[model samples]
Target: MLAGKVSLKTVRSFVLHVFVLAFSCLMIYPVLWMLSSSLKEGNEIFVNAHKLIPSVWTFSNYAEGFKGYSGQSFMVFLKNSFIVTISSVLGTVLSCTVVAYGFARISFKGAAFFFGCMMMTMMLPAEVLTIPQYIFFHKIGWVNTFAPLIIPSFFGTAFFIFLVVQFLRGLPAELDESARVDGCGHGGILFRILLPLLVPVLITVSIFKFYWTWDDFFSPLLYLTKPEMATVALALKNMSDNTFGTSWGMVFAMSIVSLAPVFLIFIALQKYIVEGISTTGMKG
Candidate 1:
Protein backbone atom coordinates (compact mmCIF):
# COMPACT_ATOMS: atom_id res chain seq x y z
CA MET A 1 0.00 0.00 0.00
CA LEU A 2 2.85 2.44 0.86
CA ALA A 3 4.65 1.69 -2.40
CA GLY A 4 1.45 2.29 -4.33
CA LYS A 5 0.96 5.65 -2.58
CA VAL A 6 4.54 6.67 -3.43
CA SER A 7 3.99 5.77 -7.07
CA LEU A 8 0.79 7.80 -7.12
CA LYS A 9 2.65 10.83 -5.70
CA THR A 10 5.34 10.43 -8.33
CA VAL A 11 2.77 10.44 -11.11
CA ARG A 12 1.13 13.57 -9.64
CA SER A 13 4.48 15.31 -9.48
CA PHE A 14 5.19 14.43 -13.11
CA VAL A 15 1.79 15.73 -14.16
CA LEU A 16 2.40 19.00 -12.34
CA HIS A 17 5.80 19.39 -13.99
CA VAL A 18 4.29 18.87 -17.44
CA PHE A 19 1.60 21.48 -16.74
CA VAL A 20 4.14 23.97 -15.44
CA LEU A 21 6.43 23.41 -18.42
CA ALA A 22 3.57 23.99 -20.86
CA PHE A 23 2.59 27.18 -19.07
CA SER A 24 6.19 28.37 -19.08
CA CYS A 25 6.38 27.85 -22.84
CA LEU A 26 3.22 29.87 -23.37
CA MET A 27 4.59 32.77 -21.35
CA ILE A 28 8.01 32.65 -23.04
CA TYR A 29 6.62 32.41 -26.58
CA PRO A 30 5.95 36.14 -27.00
CA VAL A 31 9.45 37.01 -25.81
CA LEU A 32 10.96 34.52 -28.27
CA TRP A 33 8.81 35.89 -31.08
CA MET A 34 9.82 39.46 -30.26
CA LEU A 35 13.50 38.47 -30.31
CA SER A 36 13.09 36.69 -33.62
CA SER A 37 11.18 39.63 -35.03
CA SER A 38 13.90 42.04 -33.87
CA LEU A 39 16.47 40.20 -36.00
CA LYS A 40 14.45 40.64 -39.21
CA GLU A 41 14.22 43.74 -41.42
CA GLY A 42 11.60 46.40 -40.55
CA ASN A 43 9.55 45.44 -43.63
CA GLU A 44 9.82 41.68 -43.01
CA ILE A 45 8.14 41.78 -39.57
CA PHE A 46 4.72 42.90 -40.77
CA VAL A 47 5.00 41.17 -44.14
CA ASN A 48 5.71 37.75 -42.69
CA ALA A 49 4.14 37.04 -39.31
CA HIS A 50 3.55 33.49 -40.55
CA LYS A 51 7.23 33.07 -41.50
CA LEU A 52 9.38 31.95 -38.56
CA ILE A 53 12.73 32.64 -40.27
CA PRO A 54 13.95 36.20 -40.81
CA SER A 55 14.16 37.34 -44.41
CA VAL A 56 17.56 38.82 -43.55
CA TRP A 57 19.17 38.80 -40.09
CA THR A 58 20.95 42.00 -39.20
CA PHE A 59 22.66 43.38 -36.05
CA SER A 60 22.44 46.87 -37.55
CA ASN A 61 19.10 47.56 -35.90
CA TYR A 62 20.76 47.40 -32.50
CA ALA A 63 23.61 49.55 -33.79
CA GLU A 64 21.20 52.05 -35.33
CA GLY A 65 19.11 52.14 -32.13
CA PHE A 66 22.21 53.09 -30.15
CA LYS A 67 22.85 55.89 -32.63
CA GLY A 68 19.13 56.75 -32.72
CA TYR A 69 19.29 58.89 -29.59
CA SER A 70 21.05 62.24 -29.89
CA GLY A 71 21.85 63.12 -26.25
CA GLN A 72 20.94 59.91 -24.36
CA SER A 73 22.87 56.79 -25.22
CA PHE A 74 21.52 53.35 -24.35
CA MET A 75 24.56 53.06 -22.06
CA VAL A 76 23.56 56.19 -20.16
CA PHE A 77 20.00 54.95 -19.70
CA LEU A 78 21.46 51.69 -18.37
CA LYS A 79 23.70 53.57 -15.93
CA ASN A 80 20.82 55.74 -14.71
CA SER A 81 18.68 52.61 -14.19
CA PHE A 82 21.43 50.95 -12.16
CA ILE A 83 21.85 54.05 -9.98
CA VAL A 84 18.15 54.34 -9.22
CA THR A 85 17.71 50.61 -8.54
CA ILE A 86 20.77 50.19 -6.30
CA SER A 87 20.10 53.29 -4.20
CA SER A 88 16.42 52.45 -3.79
CA VAL A 89 17.17 48.83 -2.76
CA LEU A 90 19.70 49.97 -0.17
CA GLY A 91 17.30 52.57 1.19
CA THR A 92 14.37 50.17 1.36
CA VAL A 93 16.39 47.46 3.12
CA LEU A 94 17.83 49.82 5.75
CA SER A 95 14.52 51.57 6.44
CA CYS A 96 12.31 48.47 6.29
CA THR A 97 14.49 46.25 8.54
CA VAL A 98 14.79 48.94 11.20
CA VAL A 99 11.04 49.62 11.14
CA ALA A 100 10.23 45.89 11.15
CA TYR A 101 12.41 45.40 14.23
CA GLY A 102 10.57 48.22 15.96
CA PHE A 103 7.17 46.72 15.32
CA ALA A 104 8.27 43.14 16.13
CA ARG A 105 10.34 43.83 19.26
CA ILE A 106 9.10 47.04 20.84
CA SER A 107 6.01 47.31 23.02
CA PHE A 108 5.17 50.98 23.09
CA LYS A 109 1.77 52.71 23.13
CA GLY A 110 -0.51 52.35 20.09
CA ALA A 111 1.86 49.89 18.44
CA ALA A 112 -0.91 47.71 17.03
CA PHE A 113 -2.86 50.72 15.81
CA PHE A 114 0.21 52.10 14.04
CA PHE A 115 0.90 48.72 12.45
CA GLY A 116 -2.70 48.58 11.22
CA CYS A 117 -2.19 51.95 9.58
CA MET A 118 0.92 50.59 7.91
CA MET A 119 -1.03 47.66 6.49
CA MET A 120 -3.71 50.04 5.25
CA THR A 121 -1.18 51.71 3.01
CA MET A 122 -0.80 48.39 1.22
CA MET A 123 -4.53 48.35 0.52
CA LEU A 124 -4.47 51.83 -1.01
CA PRO A 125 -4.08 51.94 -4.82
CA ALA A 126 -1.05 53.69 -6.27
CA GLU A 127 -3.41 55.80 -8.46
CA VAL A 128 -5.07 57.30 -5.38
CA LEU A 129 -1.81 58.84 -4.18
CA THR A 130 0.00 59.37 -7.49
CA ILE A 131 -1.35 62.88 -8.12
CA PRO A 132 -1.01 63.98 -4.51
CA GLN A 133 2.50 62.56 -4.31
CA TYR A 134 3.40 64.41 -7.52
CA ILE A 135 2.01 67.63 -6.05
CA PHE A 136 3.89 67.12 -2.79
CA PHE A 137 7.12 66.54 -4.65
CA HIS A 138 6.47 69.63 -6.76
CA LYS A 139 6.08 71.66 -3.57
CA ILE A 140 9.41 70.35 -2.36
CA GLY A 141 11.20 71.03 -5.69
CA TRP A 142 11.76 67.33 -6.50
CA VAL A 143 10.29 67.31 -10.01
CA ASN A 144 12.52 66.66 -13.04
CA THR A 145 15.18 64.97 -10.87
CA PHE A 146 16.43 61.57 -9.63
CA ALA A 147 15.15 62.62 -6.21
CA PRO A 148 11.58 61.85 -7.23
CA LEU A 149 12.50 58.48 -8.72
CA ILE A 150 14.89 57.43 -5.93
CA ILE A 151 14.19 59.36 -2.72
CA PRO A 152 10.85 57.89 -1.65
CA SER A 153 12.69 54.65 -0.84
CA PHE A 154 14.57 56.28 2.07
CA PHE A 155 11.37 56.23 4.07
CA GLY A 156 10.56 52.76 5.42
CA THR A 157 8.24 50.82 3.10
CA ALA A 158 5.22 49.37 4.88
CA PHE A 159 4.99 46.04 3.02
CA PHE A 160 8.63 45.13 3.59
CA ILE A 161 8.28 46.01 7.27
CA PHE A 162 5.17 43.87 7.60
CA LEU A 163 6.89 40.91 5.89
CA VAL A 164 9.90 41.31 8.18
CA VAL A 165 7.74 41.63 11.28
CA GLN A 166 6.00 38.35 10.54
CA PHE A 167 9.33 36.62 9.96
CA LEU A 168 10.79 38.19 13.13
CA ARG A 169 7.84 37.09 15.24
CA GLY A 170 8.44 33.52 14.12
CA LEU A 171 12.01 33.69 15.43
CA PRO A 172 12.64 32.13 18.87
CA ALA A 173 12.33 34.62 21.74
CA GLU A 174 14.91 32.78 23.86
CA LEU A 175 17.69 34.33 21.78
CA ASP A 176 16.55 37.81 22.73
CA GLU A 177 16.13 36.76 26.38
CA SER A 178 19.60 35.28 26.52
CA ALA A 179 21.09 38.40 24.99
CA ARG A 180 19.25 40.52 27.54
CA VAL A 181 20.53 38.36 30.38
CA ASP A 182 24.09 38.80 29.09
CA GLY A 183 23.79 42.58 29.58
CA CYS A 184 23.06 43.28 25.92
CA GLY A 185 20.87 46.29 25.16
CA HIS A 186 18.06 46.20 22.62
CA GLY A 187 20.21 47.78 19.97
CA GLY A 188 23.08 45.38 20.57
CA ILE A 189 20.80 42.38 20.61
CA LEU A 190 19.21 43.51 17.37
CA PHE A 191 22.51 44.18 15.68
CA ARG A 192 24.43 41.16 16.98
CA ILE A 193 21.77 38.51 17.32
CA LEU A 194 18.59 39.46 15.47
CA LEU A 195 19.75 41.17 12.30
CA PRO A 196 22.28 38.47 11.55
CA LEU A 197 19.60 35.80 11.73
CA LEU A 198 17.21 37.90 9.71
CA VAL A 199 19.52 37.82 6.69
CA PRO A 200 17.12 35.68 4.64
CA VAL A 201 14.20 38.06 4.97
CA LEU A 202 16.51 41.03 4.43
CA ILE A 203 17.75 39.49 1.19
CA THR A 204 14.18 38.81 0.10
CA VAL A 205 13.17 42.42 0.66
CA SER A 206 16.27 43.70 -1.16
CA ILE A 207 15.64 41.53 -4.21
CA PHE A 208 11.98 42.59 -4.48
CA LYS A 209 12.81 46.27 -4.07
CA PHE A 210 15.61 46.03 -6.62
CA TYR A 211 13.40 44.46 -9.31
CA TRP A 212 10.45 46.82 -8.72
CA THR A 213 12.58 49.96 -8.73
CA TRP A 214 14.44 48.84 -11.84
CA ASP A 215 11.18 48.35 -13.76
CA ASP A 216 9.02 51.21 -12.43
CA PHE A 217 7.83 53.72 -15.10
CA PHE A 218 5.00 55.90 -13.79
CA SER A 219 7.07 57.68 -11.18
CA PRO A 220 9.85 58.36 -13.66
CA LEU A 221 7.36 59.69 -16.22
CA LEU A 222 5.75 61.92 -13.60
CA TYR A 223 9.03 63.05 -12.03
CA LEU A 224 11.62 63.20 -14.79
CA THR A 225 11.24 65.58 -17.74
CA LYS A 226 14.62 65.26 -19.44
CA PRO A 227 15.13 62.52 -22.03
CA GLU A 228 18.41 61.64 -20.29
CA MET A 229 16.52 60.84 -17.09
CA ALA A 230 14.49 58.01 -18.65
CA THR A 231 14.62 54.53 -17.10
CA VAL A 232 14.65 51.39 -19.27
CA ALA A 233 10.84 51.24 -19.12
CA LEU A 234 10.44 54.85 -20.23
CA ALA A 235 12.95 54.32 -23.01
CA LEU A 236 10.90 51.40 -24.32
CA LYS A 237 7.74 53.53 -24.20
CA ASN A 238 9.29 56.41 -26.16
CA MET A 239 10.79 54.02 -28.71
CA SER A 240 9.21 54.78 -32.08
CA ASP A 241 7.28 57.62 -33.72
CA ASN A 242 6.97 56.45 -37.33
CA THR A 243 4.35 53.68 -37.68
CA PHE A 244 6.49 51.96 -40.30
CA GLY A 245 9.92 53.20 -39.14
CA THR A 246 9.96 51.59 -35.68
CA SER A 247 13.09 49.54 -34.96
CA TRP A 248 11.63 46.46 -33.30
CA GLY A 249 15.00 44.68 -33.52
CA MET A 250 16.86 47.21 -31.39
CA VAL A 251 13.98 47.38 -28.97
CA PHE A 252 14.29 43.63 -28.39
CA ALA A 253 18.05 43.85 -27.91
CA MET A 254 17.71 46.70 -25.41
CA SER A 255 14.96 44.84 -23.53
CA ILE A 256 17.17 41.76 -23.12
CA VAL A 257 19.94 44.03 -21.79
CA SER A 258 17.51 45.67 -19.40
CA LEU A 259 16.37 42.29 -17.99
CA ALA A 260 19.89 40.87 -17.65
CA PRO A 261 20.73 42.49 -14.30
CA VAL A 262 17.46 41.43 -12.68
CA PHE A 263 17.97 37.83 -13.80
CA LEU A 264 21.52 37.80 -12.44
CA ILE A 265 20.51 39.34 -9.11
CA PHE A 266 17.67 36.87 -8.58
CA ILE A 267 19.73 33.79 -9.48
CA ALA A 268 22.55 34.90 -7.16
CA LEU A 269 20.22 35.64 -4.20
CA GLN A 270 17.25 33.31 -4.77
CA LYS A 271 18.29 30.81 -2.10
CA TYR A 272 18.08 33.39 0.67
CA ILE A 273 14.76 34.63 -0.69
CA VAL A 274 13.12 31.18 -0.54
CA GLU A 275 14.67 30.42 2.84
CA GLY A 276 13.36 33.66 4.29
CA ILE A 277 9.81 33.01 3.10
CA SER A 278 9.92 29.41 4.34
CA THR A 279 11.02 30.50 7.83
CA THR A 280 8.27 33.09 8.22
CA GLY A 281 5.62 32.33 10.94
CA MET A 282 7.65 29.38 12.22
CA LYS A 283 9.50 31.08 15.09
CA GLY A 284 8.49 29.86 18.55
Candidate 2:
Protein backbone atom coordinates (compact mmCIF):
# COMPACT_ATOMS: atom_id res chain seq x y z
CA MET A 1 0.00 0.00 0.00
CA LEU A 2 2.85 2.42 0.82
CA ALA A 3 4.58 1.58 -2.49
CA GLY A 4 1.36 2.23 -4.40
CA LYS A 5 0.95 5.63 -2.70
CA VAL A 6 4.52 6.56 -3.75
CA SER A 7 3.79 5.55 -7.32
CA LEU A 8 0.62 7.68 -7.37
CA LYS A 9 2.57 10.73 -6.11
CA THR A 10 5.18 10.28 -8.82
CA VAL A 11 2.51 10.10 -11.53
CA ARG A 12 0.83 13.26 -10.23
CA SER A 13 4.14 15.18 -10.33
CA PHE A 14 4.79 13.97 -13.87
CA VAL A 15 1.35 15.08 -15.01
CA LEU A 16 1.76 18.50 -13.41
CA HIS A 17 5.10 19.04 -15.14
CA VAL A 18 3.67 17.99 -18.50
CA PHE A 19 0.69 20.36 -18.10
CA VAL A 20 2.89 23.35 -17.23
CA LEU A 21 5.28 22.69 -20.11
CA ALA A 22 2.43 22.44 -22.61
CA PHE A 23 0.88 25.68 -21.31
CA SER A 24 4.19 27.50 -21.58
CA CYS A 25 4.59 26.34 -25.18
CA LEU A 26 1.05 27.46 -25.97
CA MET A 27 1.77 30.94 -24.53
CA ILE A 28 4.91 31.34 -26.66
CA TYR A 29 3.56 29.76 -29.86
CA PRO A 30 2.66 33.12 -31.48
CA VAL A 31 6.20 34.46 -31.03
CA LEU A 32 7.63 31.22 -32.42
CA TRP A 33 5.28 31.45 -35.38
CA MET A 34 6.29 35.05 -36.11
CA LEU A 35 9.98 34.16 -36.01
CA SER A 36 9.38 31.26 -38.36
CA SER A 37 7.28 33.39 -40.73
CA SER A 38 9.95 36.08 -40.86
CA LEU A 39 12.34 33.50 -42.39
CA LYS A 40 9.83 32.08 -44.86
CA GLU A 41 9.21 33.05 -48.48
CA GLY A 42 6.17 35.29 -49.08
CA ASN A 43 3.92 32.61 -50.57
CA GLU A 44 4.83 30.05 -47.92
CA ILE A 45 3.90 32.24 -44.91
CA PHE A 46 0.08 31.85 -45.06
CA VAL A 47 0.24 28.53 -46.89
CA ASN A 48 2.33 26.90 -44.15
CA ALA A 49 0.99 28.91 -41.18
CA HIS A 50 0.67 25.66 -39.30
CA LYS A 51 4.32 24.77 -39.83
CA LEU A 52 7.09 26.01 -37.54
CA ILE A 53 9.91 25.59 -40.11
CA PRO A 54 10.32 26.81 -43.67
CA SER A 55 11.36 24.48 -46.49
CA VAL A 56 13.21 27.38 -48.17
CA TRP A 57 14.38 30.19 -45.89
CA THR A 58 14.82 33.62 -47.45
CA PHE A 59 16.73 36.51 -45.86
CA SER A 60 15.66 38.96 -48.59
CA ASN A 61 12.71 40.09 -46.45
CA TYR A 62 15.04 41.86 -44.03
CA ALA A 63 16.90 43.49 -46.92
CA GLU A 64 13.71 44.71 -48.58
CA GLY A 65 12.30 46.01 -45.28
CA PHE A 66 15.50 47.92 -44.55
CA LYS A 67 15.20 49.72 -47.90
CA GLY A 68 12.49 51.86 -46.18
CA TYR A 69 10.12 54.46 -47.61
CA SER A 70 11.28 57.45 -49.66
CA GLY A 71 15.11 57.69 -49.60
CA GLN A 72 15.72 56.95 -45.92
CA SER A 73 16.75 53.53 -44.60
CA PHE A 74 15.15 51.60 -41.73
CA MET A 75 18.28 52.40 -39.68
CA VAL A 76 17.02 55.99 -39.43
CA PHE A 77 13.80 54.84 -37.73
CA LEU A 78 15.77 52.61 -35.36
CA LYS A 79 18.08 55.47 -34.44
CA ASN A 80 15.10 57.71 -33.68
CA SER A 81 13.62 55.02 -31.43
CA PHE A 82 16.90 54.66 -29.52
CA ILE A 83 17.29 58.39 -28.97
CA VAL A 84 13.74 58.86 -27.65
CA THR A 85 13.74 55.71 -25.54
CA ILE A 86 17.13 56.38 -23.93
CA SER A 87 16.32 60.01 -23.18
CA SER A 88 12.92 59.16 -21.71
CA VAL A 89 14.48 56.45 -19.53
CA LEU A 90 17.08 58.86 -18.15
CA GLY A 91 14.51 61.58 -17.45
CA THR A 92 12.14 59.15 -15.73
CA VAL A 93 14.91 57.80 -13.50
CA LEU A 94 16.04 61.25 -12.43
CA SER A 95 12.61 62.78 -11.89
CA CYS A 96 10.93 59.79 -10.26
CA THR A 97 13.79 59.13 -7.82
CA VAL A 98 13.87 62.74 -6.63
CA VAL A 99 10.08 63.00 -6.23
CA ALA A 100 9.85 59.63 -4.49
CA TYR A 101 12.52 60.61 -1.99
CA GLY A 102 10.48 63.67 -1.09
CA PHE A 103 7.26 61.71 -0.57
CA ALA A 104 8.96 58.85 1.26
CA ARG A 105 11.44 60.72 3.49
CA ILE A 106 10.96 64.46 3.71
CA SER A 107 7.75 65.51 5.40
CA PHE A 108 6.29 68.83 4.28
CA LYS A 109 3.08 70.89 4.32
CA GLY A 110 0.16 69.28 2.49
CA ALA A 111 2.33 66.27 1.69
CA ALA A 112 -0.51 63.82 2.22
CA PHE A 113 -2.88 65.83 0.06
CA PHE A 114 -0.33 66.14 -2.75
CA PHE A 115 0.51 62.45 -2.60
CA GLY A 116 -3.21 61.67 -2.85
CA CYS A 117 -3.47 63.92 -5.91
CA MET A 118 -0.57 62.13 -7.54
CA MET A 119 -2.20 58.76 -6.85
CA MET A 120 -5.45 59.95 -8.39
CA THR A 121 -3.58 60.90 -11.55
CA MET A 122 -2.33 57.33 -11.77
CA MET A 123 -5.94 56.21 -12.18
CA LEU A 124 -6.53 58.80 -14.91
CA PRO A 125 -6.56 57.45 -18.45
CA ALA A 126 -3.81 58.74 -20.73
CA GLU A 127 -6.25 59.29 -23.62
CA VAL A 128 -8.02 62.02 -21.64
CA LEU A 129 -4.86 64.14 -21.61
CA THR A 130 -3.72 63.73 -25.21
CA ILE A 131 -5.71 66.51 -26.85
CA PRO A 132 -4.72 69.20 -24.33
CA GLN A 133 -1.11 67.98 -24.40
CA TYR A 134 -1.06 68.23 -28.19
CA ILE A 135 -2.40 71.76 -28.09
CA PHE A 136 0.14 72.81 -25.46
CA PHE A 137 3.05 71.32 -27.39
CA HIS A 138 1.83 72.83 -30.63
CA LYS A 139 1.66 76.28 -29.02
CA ILE A 140 5.27 75.87 -27.93
CA GLY A 141 6.36 74.94 -31.47
CA TRP A 142 7.28 71.44 -30.25
CA VAL A 143 5.08 69.76 -32.87
CA ASN A 144 7.04 68.12 -35.70
CA THR A 145 9.99 67.89 -33.28
CA PHE A 146 11.38 65.32 -30.84
CA ALA A 147 10.57 67.72 -27.99
CA PRO A 148 6.93 66.67 -27.98
CA LEU A 149 7.87 63.02 -27.83
CA ILE A 150 10.62 63.39 -25.23
CA ILE A 151 10.25 66.46 -22.97
CA PRO A 152 7.32 65.56 -20.68
CA SER A 153 9.27 62.56 -19.35
CA PHE A 154 11.42 64.96 -17.32
CA PHE A 155 8.36 65.55 -15.14
CA GLY A 156 7.93 62.56 -12.83
CA THR A 157 5.63 59.86 -14.11
CA ALA A 158 3.01 59.03 -11.45
CA PHE A 159 3.41 55.25 -11.78
CA PHE A 160 7.19 55.34 -11.38
CA ILE A 161 6.95 57.87 -8.57
CA PHE A 162 4.51 55.59 -6.70
CA LEU A 163 6.66 52.56 -7.34
CA VAL A 164 9.76 54.22 -5.95
CA VAL A 165 7.80 55.69 -3.05
CA GLN A 166 6.61 52.25 -2.01
CA PHE A 167 10.13 50.86 -2.17
CA LEU A 168 11.53 53.78 -0.17
CA ARG A 169 8.83 53.45 2.52
CA GLY A 170 9.96 49.85 3.04
CA LEU A 171 13.36 51.13 4.26
CA PRO A 172 14.02 52.07 7.89
CA ALA A 173 13.69 55.77 8.79
CA GLU A 174 16.77 55.33 11.01
CA LEU A 175 18.91 55.60 7.92
CA ASP A 176 17.82 59.20 7.50
CA GLU A 177 18.48 59.98 11.17
CA SER A 178 21.95 58.40 10.96
CA ALA A 179 22.74 60.34 7.83
CA ARG A 180 21.64 63.56 9.51
CA VAL A 181 23.85 62.81 12.54
CA ASP A 182 26.76 62.44 10.15
CA GLY A 183 26.18 66.02 8.90
CA CYS A 184 24.53 64.90 5.67
CA GLY A 185 21.78 67.11 4.24
CA HIS A 186 18.79 65.63 2.41
CA GLY A 187 20.49 65.86 -0.99
CA GLY A 188 23.74 64.46 0.37
CA ILE A 189 21.98 61.58 2.11
CA LEU A 190 19.92 60.69 -0.95
CA PHE A 191 22.86 60.85 -3.33
CA ARG A 192 25.50 59.26 -1.11
CA ILE A 193 23.45 56.65 0.74
CA LEU A 194 20.09 55.80 -0.76
CA LEU A 195 21.14 56.04 -4.43
CA PRO A 196 23.30 52.94 -4.22
CA LEU A 197 20.56 50.93 -2.55
CA LEU A 198 18.08 52.15 -5.17
CA VAL A 199 19.74 50.17 -7.97
CA PRO A 200 17.10 47.45 -8.22
CA VAL A 201 14.06 49.75 -8.30
CA LEU A 202 15.84 52.18 -10.60
CA ILE A 203 16.61 49.38 -13.02
CA THR A 204 12.97 48.37 -12.86
CA VAL A 205 11.92 51.92 -13.76
CA SER A 206 14.44 52.10 -16.62
CA ILE A 207 13.29 48.80 -18.09
CA PHE A 208 9.63 49.91 -18.02
CA LYS A 209 10.45 53.33 -19.50
CA PHE A 210 12.53 51.76 -22.27
CA TYR A 211 9.83 49.22 -23.16
CA TRP A 212 6.97 51.74 -23.34
CA THR A 213 8.90 54.37 -25.30
CA TRP A 214 10.23 51.85 -27.80
CA ASP A 215 6.76 50.47 -28.49
CA ASP A 216 5.02 53.89 -28.69
CA PHE A 217 3.47 54.46 -32.10
CA PHE A 218 0.75 57.09 -31.68
CA SER A 219 2.94 59.89 -30.29
CA PRO A 220 5.47 59.51 -33.08
CA LEU A 221 2.74 59.36 -35.70
CA LEU A 222 1.14 62.55 -34.33
CA TYR A 223 4.38 64.56 -33.99
CA LEU A 224 6.76 63.21 -36.62
CA THR A 225 5.15 63.80 -39.99
CA LYS A 226 8.46 63.81 -41.85
CA PRO A 227 9.62 60.45 -43.20
CA GLU A 228 13.18 61.10 -41.98
CA MET A 229 11.89 61.63 -38.43
CA ALA A 230 9.71 58.52 -38.28
CA THR A 231 10.30 56.05 -35.45
CA VAL A 232 10.45 52.24 -35.80
CA ALA A 233 6.81 51.84 -34.69
CA LEU A 234 5.52 54.44 -37.15
CA ALA A 235 7.66 53.06 -39.95
CA LEU A 236 6.31 49.57 -39.34
CA LYS A 237 2.76 50.92 -39.51
CA ASN A 238 3.51 52.49 -42.86
CA MET A 239 4.66 49.10 -44.18
CA SER A 240 1.05 47.89 -44.29
CA ASP A 241 -0.84 48.52 -47.55
CA ASN A 242 -4.59 47.96 -47.81
CA THR A 243 -5.21 49.65 -51.19
CA PHE A 244 -2.35 47.82 -52.79
CA GLY A 245 -0.44 44.71 -51.66
CA THR A 246 1.33 44.76 -48.33
CA SER A 247 4.63 42.87 -48.14
CA TRP A 248 3.91 40.36 -45.35
CA GLY A 249 7.48 39.03 -45.43
CA MET A 250 9.02 42.50 -44.96
CA VAL A 251 6.51 43.33 -42.21
CA PHE A 252 7.32 40.16 -40.30
CA ALA A 253 11.10 40.66 -40.74
CA MET A 254 11.05 44.25 -39.43
CA SER A 255 8.68 43.29 -36.62
CA ILE A 256 11.32 40.81 -35.45
CA VAL A 257 14.01 43.51 -35.62
CA SER A 258 11.85 45.99 -33.69
CA LEU A 259 11.23 43.55 -30.80
CA ALA A 260 14.91 42.61 -30.34
CA PRO A 261 16.04 45.46 -28.05
CA VAL A 262 12.99 45.24 -25.74
CA PHE A 263 13.45 41.45 -25.43
CA LEU A 264 17.18 41.74 -24.68
CA ILE A 265 16.76 44.48 -22.05
CA PHE A 266 13.89 42.71 -20.28
CA ILE A 267 15.78 39.39 -20.19
CA ALA A 268 18.89 41.03 -18.78
CA LEU A 269 17.12 43.12 -16.12
CA GLN A 270 14.14 40.87 -15.27
CA LYS A 271 15.65 39.67 -12.00
CA TYR A 272 15.82 43.21 -10.67
CA ILE A 273 12.18 43.75 -11.66
CA VAL A 274 11.17 40.74 -9.59
CA GLU A 275 13.31 41.86 -6.65
CA GLY A 276 12.10 45.47 -6.61
CA ILE A 277 8.38 44.73 -6.90
CA SER A 278 8.48 41.88 -4.40
CA THR A 279 10.11 43.98 -1.64
CA THR A 280 7.88 47.03 -2.21
CA GLY A 281 5.03 45.95 0.08
CA MET A 282 7.20 44.51 2.86
CA LYS A 283 6.73 47.60 5.01
CA GLY A 284 4.61 50.14 3.16
Per-prediction TM-score, please? 0.84, 0.91
1-284, model 1: which lDDT tens digit per residue? 46656787788988999999999988888877777777778777778575667879987767766653646788878888888989998899888888888899989999999999999998788899889889999999988788977788989888889888988999999999999999999888889999989987888888778778888888888887777887777777777545435677777767777778877876898776566547543211
lDDT string, candidate 2, 138-224, tens digits: 898888789988888999998899989988998888988999999999999899989998887888888878888899988998899
lDDT of each: 0.80, 0.87
Best by lDDT: 2
Worst 10 residues of 2 by lDDT: 275-284
- Index of the highest-TM-score prediction: 2
For every candidate in turn, the CA RMSD to the true structure comes to 5.1, 3.3
Candidate 1, residue 141: the lDDT equals: 94
